[model samples]
Target: MRLYRMRLYRIALWVTVPMALPLLAAPAGLTAVRAARDTAPEGAPSVWRPGVTAQPVDAGRPFPALGAASMALRRMVPRPAIVSRAQWRADETKRDSHAHYAGGVRAVFIHHTDTPNGYDCADVPRTLRNLYTGQTRDRSWGDLGYNFLVDKCGTVYEGRAGGADRAVVGSHTLGFNQGTTGIAAIGTFGPGTPVPAAMEHAIAALAAWKLGLSGVDPTGKVRLTSTNGKSRYARGTSAEFDAISGHRDGFATNCPGEALIARLPAIRGLAAEIQGRYARAVPFPRLAATPGNTHRG
Candidate 1:
C-alpha cells in the first residue's frame, strides 16, 4: 500500500486498538467458498435462494461507552480477505492498464450491481467477469468501476486492477470517486427486498478497516468536490457526505436501492464499534467489592 505522508500517524495508531475478537475468522460461509472456473458457465443451475426476512447482526446491538483514549488508540480491525482480479479470473487482456491512486481514503460509498439476487455463491467469479465485460465492453470503462464487491454470502471480491492495499481511484459514484472506496453489493436491493445479515457484516468489517487506515470516522462527515456535472453536485462544487454513504448521495440514481440504504445508520455504528471507537476499554457496571467479582488491583 502506497500511503500518503500525511496519514503516517493515523496509520501508526490504527494498529494498536484492542479487539474483542483478535483472531476472528472470516464471516460465516466464506471459509467454504471457492472460486468457480475462469469462464462463465453455460448456465447457472444452482442458486441457493435465501429467505425474505433478513436476520440482524451485531451492528444492531447497542454500542458501549466512548473511551476517552479511543481516538488515540485508533480504529483497528482485521482486514477482510479480498479475492483479487486474478483469483476471480478477470480477462486481463480486455482491460486498459490505466491506474489512478489517491493520497488516502476519506470515505466509502455503497452500491448495488442492479442484477438479480438469486445467484449461486459459487458463480461469483463468473458474475464478476460478466460485470467486468459490462463495464469494460458495454460502458466502455477501462476496468471495473467498484474498488470492491461483496456477495450475499459475505465473500469479498477485489474489483479494479490496483491492489486493494492502495488507494485506487474508481469510476463509481460519478463525482465522488476520488479519496473514496466504492463497495458494490453484488445484487439488486430494492424496496421490500431483504438484505442478508452476512452481507451487512462483511461490508461493515471492510469499511472499518479501509476508513480506519486514514483515521476517518465511519459515522462522521467528509467534504468532497465534484468533477463531473452528471452528478447531483455540479462540477467544482464541494459537498459534505457521511464517511459511509449511499450511491444516490452524489448522483441522480436509485442505485444501492432503498432496502440497503436503510441499513446505512446501523452499518456506520457497527464500523465504528469494530474500530474500537464505540467499544469499551473498561468493564461495564464496574466490578463489585465481593470476593467473586473483585478486581486483583
Candidate 2:
C-alpha cells in the first residue's frame, strides 16, 4: 500500500483473517488501498497554559471505539483516541517513498521526542510539523519515525504516512523496529519531571488496543528479531522484550529517559487491565468535548 501523499486510497479490504506471520512484501507497482476512515480532528487548543496539569482519566483519556470499520485486532476492547495524519497536517510529500510492513505487530516501543514538554495542548499540530521537518529533512529519516505520538494532554496523533491500523514499518529503533510499533511521547521526560497521568493512560490504552489486535498481553514478554548489529542484539538474533518497552531497551540511547522508563510497570498494568487480562479497567464515561481530544482501534 505505497500511496502518494494526497492520493485517495482506491483499493480497500475488510480484513477478517488474522494476519500474523511473515509480513507481506510491498508490490512493485503502486496500488491504492482504502483503509478505515480516521476519526475527525479535534478543535485546536484555545489557549496555551504552561505547566498546566492534564485532565484526569475519567475526563481526559476516554476510550473511543474504532467503530465496525476497523481491521479486526481479534479483540473486543475499545480502541484509544487517535488523530489521523490529516488531522496533524503531515506533509506526505516529504514522506519516505519506501514504506514497509511487518504483517502484524508483535510489540510496541516507547520513546520521548526529546523536546520541551511545556507546549500548549493547542499547538500539538504545529509541534508535529516541526518534528516532521527535523526527522525527514534534518535527520534524513524520511518521515516522522514514530508510528504514533502522545501529548501531555493525552491526545494521540498518527505519526507515519500509512494507516495507523496497518503495520507500517517505522524507522524508530535501529535494529528492533521490524514486527513492532513505535509510540513517542511528545515531550522531554527526564528524571524528576512528573509524567502526566493522562499521557500514561493514553499510552496504555493505545498499546493495549494495538497489542490486542495480535492477541498479545501487554504484561507478557515477546520475542523480536534484531535487524541491526549496532543494536543490543546482532542482526537476526531473537530477543525477549516486555510487550511495552522503552527505546533504551533496544538502542544505546537514553531516549525515553529513566523517569518514563520507571513508569513502564504501571503502563503495562493499565494496558493489561484494559485488555481484561487483569481487573477490568474503569468504565469509560462520556466526557465533555475538550479542545484537543479525538480515535482508531
Candidate 3:
C-alpha cells in the first residue's frame, strides 16, 4: 500500500509540472502579441485587422478568368467603336515601337495629345501612329507613350496590353513610370473648350474601376504638393481612390490640356461618388486619400 501511494504522488507531480509551465509562458506570449500589434502601421492591411479597407470602388467588368466581381466598370459615355484592327496594325508598324512594359499598374496619368486644332478630324489611327512613331519617336521614346488612347469621338483604344482590368505598367512619364498607367485624350481641352459629356462619363467610370482595383478611394481629396518625407494626403486619403492626375504633375509638358486640368477637382468628386455607390453595392471600406495628384507606391 505504501509503495502504491508513493507512485501515485509521483505521477501527479509530473502532470502538474507540465500544466504549470504553460501558464507561466502565457503572459510572455501575450506580451509579444501586443507589441507586434502596437507596432503595426495604420491604413496598411494585416491579418489581424482584416477590416482595414483599401479602395472603395469595384473593379468594373470582370475578366472571364478573374470572376464576376472582377468585371471592369466601363460605362460608355458614348457608343465609341474600336478602331479597325487593320488600322491599329498599320499604325503599330508605321509608328516607332519601343520598350514594352512588364510591370504592375498602380496609378493613372491623363494627357492631351497637344495636337493642333482641326487635326481632331484627321484619321484616328494615322494620328495615333504619327504621335507614337513621329512625335514621341522623335523625342526618343518607345512606341506611343500612352497605355490607352481616347479619340475625339470619345472612343477609348488599347495602346498597350495589360490595360483591360489588369495592372499594366506603360511608359508615360519619367520618375513616375514604375506603377503608373497612362491615358491620353486625342484633342486638347483649353479655355472656352469643354470635354464631351460622354468622354467625362467614360473617364469617371474607368477611373472608378482603376481606383477599386488599386485599392484607392475616388472621393478622397489629394493635395498637389508633398512635405517632409510623408504625403500630406496619405493619412487622410483612401488607398482605393484613383490617383486621377494630369501629366504636368510629373513632367514639364502640359499634356492633359489646361481645361481638363482645371476640371480635375470636379472630376475627382464625380469619380468618388461613382466609387462610393459601387462600394455600397458590394460593401468595402472607403479608400483613403493620398497627397499629390498621383500615388507614389
Candidate 4:
C-alpha cells in the first residue's frame, strides 16, 4: 500500500510539473516578443504600421469615351505623336493589355527612353518590337514601356491603349502608375539637347485637356521637399497645378533629363493657364442653401 501510494504521488508530480513548466515559460517568451516589437526602429514596418495602402489602378468612371470634340481637338493639335508598332502587336496578341477603362485622370508623368537620338519616331513600332524580342541586346523589357511616345517631329503616338482612357499598366515608375498618365519622348534629353518647344507645347495641351475633363486644376502648385524637411522645389506652388514631374521624383534614375526637368516651372505655368481657361468655360458647381419656412396660414 505504501509503495502504491508513492508511485501514484510520483506520477501526479510528473504530470503537474510538465503543465506548470509551460505556464512559467510562456509569459517570459511572450514578454520578450512584445519588448522586441516595441523597441523596433522608426520606418521599420510592424503590425501597427502596415505600410501605405496600394492605390487603385481602376476604380472610378473613366472620362466619357473620347467624343467627336476631343477627337477633333487631338487631330487639330498637330503635336507629332506616334504609337509604337510593338504596342500594336501586343494589342493584337491580347497580352499585357487592360480590359477595363481607367478611373478619373489625375496627374501626368514624363519620361525619356534613353535611346539614341537618330532613331526615328516613325519607325517606333519596329524599334519597340525589336527591343521586346531581345533583338536589342543592350536594352531590357519585352515591349514598348510607355503609354504615349512623342517623336522629335512633335507628333504624338498612341501606346498600349486597348480602349480610350483604359487603366493600362505601364513600367514607368515604382509606386506612381496609379492615377498618373505617363508620356515618354522617343530620344534621350540631357545638358546639350532640350526638349523642343513644339513637343513641350503638345504635352502641355494634352495634360491640360485631361485635367480639365477630370475637374482638377492643372495650374495648382506643388513643392517637393527633401526627406530632411528642406524645400527642394520652391514653396507656395501647387504640386498638382505643376502637374509636370520627372520620373526621378519617385525612383532613382536620371530620366526625363536635367534640361527637361529645368523647364518644369514653365511647363507647369502653361498647364495652370490652360486650367484657368477651362474653368472659365465650365464653372464649378456650388451647393444650394435651404430656405427656412414660417408658419403657414
Best by TM-score: 2
Candidate that beats the other on lDDT, 2 or 4, i.e. the better one = 2
Question: Model 4 — which ten-residue stretch has the worst lDDT?
Answer: 33-42
Query: Clash number for model 2?
Result: 4
Model 4, 1-297: lDDT tens per residue?
Answer: 999999999999987785533322222222121111110011211222222122233222223334423211221222223333434453334232222223335666788878787864456565455444441123322224455766565556565444324444344544444445667876788977866665666566666655555555555533221111122223222233245677777555788998777766666566555555443322322212222222111
Model 3, span 1-297: residue lDDT tens: 999999999999987786533322222222221211100111111122322212111121222343344323433232224343344553455332323232234556788877754654336666666665653445544345566776544556666533255444445654343345677877878776776655565565566666666555554433221111232222223332237778777555666878877766666666667665443212222333311111110
Give the whole-model CA lDDT for all candidates, comma-separated: 0.72, 0.71, 0.50, 0.48
How do the residues 166-247 of candidate 1 rate in per-residue lDDT, one tens digit apiece?
A: 7766778776776788999999999989887778878888999999887888888888777566788876688899999999
For model 2, the stretches where C-alpha displacement exceeds 4 angstroms are 1-73, 279-297
> Looking at model 3, which ten-residue stretch has the lowest summed lDDT?
33-42
TM-scores vs. true structure, each candidate: 0.69, 0.70, 0.54, 0.53
* Candidate 2 C-alpha lDDT tens digits along 1-297: 356532433322224445567845434322332221111011111221322222211122223345433223455578777888887777789865555555467789999999998888878898899989888776666578889999988888899766788676677887766667899999998998888888888888899888888777788788776656778887667789998999999988998998899888888888887787755333333222223553222
What TM-score does candidate 2 get on C-alpha atoms? Answer: 0.70
Tell me how many clashing residue pairs each candidate has: 0, 4, 28, 24
Candidate 2 has which clashing residue pairs, if any? 11-33, 11-34, 73-213, 82-295
Residue-level lDDT for 237 in candidate 3: 32
